[model samples]
Target: MGTKIGVIGGSGVYEIDGLQDAAWVDIDSPFGAPSDQILTGRLGGVEMAFLPRHGRGHVHSPSTVPYRANIDALKRLGVTDVISVSACGSFREEMAPGDFVIVDQFIDRTFAREKSFFGTGLVAHVSVAHPTCPRLSQACLEAARAEGIKVHDGGTYLAMEGPQFSSMAESKLYRDAWGCDVIGMTNMPEAKLAREAELCYASVAMITDYDSWHPDHGAVDISDIIATLTGNADKARALVARLPALLGPERAPCPHGCDRALEHAILTAPEKRDPAMIEKLSAVAGRVLG
Candidate 1:
């Protein structure tokens, strides 16, 4: 099969433009309904799928996004690469508002959400030591540069569970103590589930504000964030538009083993696994299960 790129849009980004034969596809997944219908079509002669992390009209909150179903839906559609474009607050002065960071590491501090596709019935563990696919991330970096976006090549993202912005103390902890480069709400379980689904994933964090850490910036203001978010969204679209041309309509095995994550991850014996659970995981774990 040829390469099919999936773009998960967040915050101000609701849809992508310039897709040929674009259609909003309702893909069913055992996990649940995805955040919204996925928009699938061709861009630059390469298959592309775009899913709004929050449903259209911004219905779903960051914590409420159906991470499992979103990943499963894309995998079922044969999406080989998943690129997450999300709005974030920068921890570093250099990664200021309107900048884009190609995130390579994550510190998942999120809770109150389903974080895996495997559980008691189907026990499995995938190594996420290096979660984002390097190859895919490099493409994002190049695309952003080509769009004249001030892009940072690598950064550690601190994913917090939130419908609320971070407190001053919390922001300080993540920036000063944790050495995190950016902070965002979505992207934790989403990144984790992508690894489990054996789909290569990359994250592009668009900086909107300095999260209560900068003395001059003070607290995060909704008005300011929304304003920056609007500009960032436009650049994000341009960056995504350039991806298909760089990645081309061809697929290759992930050198970093993102596509083979479940090779030795499943621990349950064939007979020991629950039949119902196995059936539910068919789309996500079909290769290993078969």
Candidate 2:
């Protein structure tokens, strides 16, 4: 099978360009309804799928995104590579507003969302020691550079559960004490769920503000974030448009082991696994489960 790329658009980014035969297709996932109908088509002869993380018109909050269903829906659509483009607040001045960071690690502080596909009935544990897929992330970094976008090669993303921006104290702690590079509300369970689905996931964090830690910036202003997001969104689309050629229309097994994450990750013995849970996991874990 050829490579099928999936792009998850975040705040201020509702869609992408340069797709041929683009169509919004409704994909029903067993987990639940995805954030929105997926936009699928071909870009530079490579299959592509786009999903708005917040849905069209920005209907869902950060905490309300259907993380599990989103990953399942992409997996169901045969997306071999998943690219998440989200807006974030930077901790360092060098990673200023309008910059892009290819996040390679995550500190998941989100508590309310469903973070996994396996549970009581069936059990599995996938290694996330190095969260983002290196090969895919490198492709993102190169694409951004090719587009003349100031993009950092790697950084750690702190995923917080929020509809509200962080307090001064919280922002300072995450920036100084924890050494986080960029902070965002999405990407937690979304990245985790992608691993559980055995998909090669890469995160492209677009910097919008300096958070509340910067003395000059004071607090996160909606007006400021909106302005930066608007500019960053345009650059993000250009970077995405360059991906198909770099990644090519065909793919081999992931050299970093992203494609075979479930190889030795399942713990439940075949006989002991629940039939219902196994059925539910069919799409995400079918390779190892079968």
lDDT of 2 by residue, 26-82 (tens): 998889999999999999999999999999999999999998999999999999999
Winning model by lDDT = 1
Count clashing residue pairs in model 1. 0
List candidate 1 stretches off by more than 4 Å: none
Residue-level lDDT of model 1, residues 1-290, one tens digit each, is 69999999999998999999999999999999999999999999999999999999999998889999999999999999999999999999999999999999999999889999999978998999999999999999999998899999999999999889999999999998999999999999999999999999999999999999999999999999999999999999999999999999988788999999999999998989999998999989999998
Per-model TM-score versus the true fold: 0.99, 0.99
What C-alpha lDDT, on a 0 to 100 scale, does residue 142 get in candidate 1?
Answer: 94
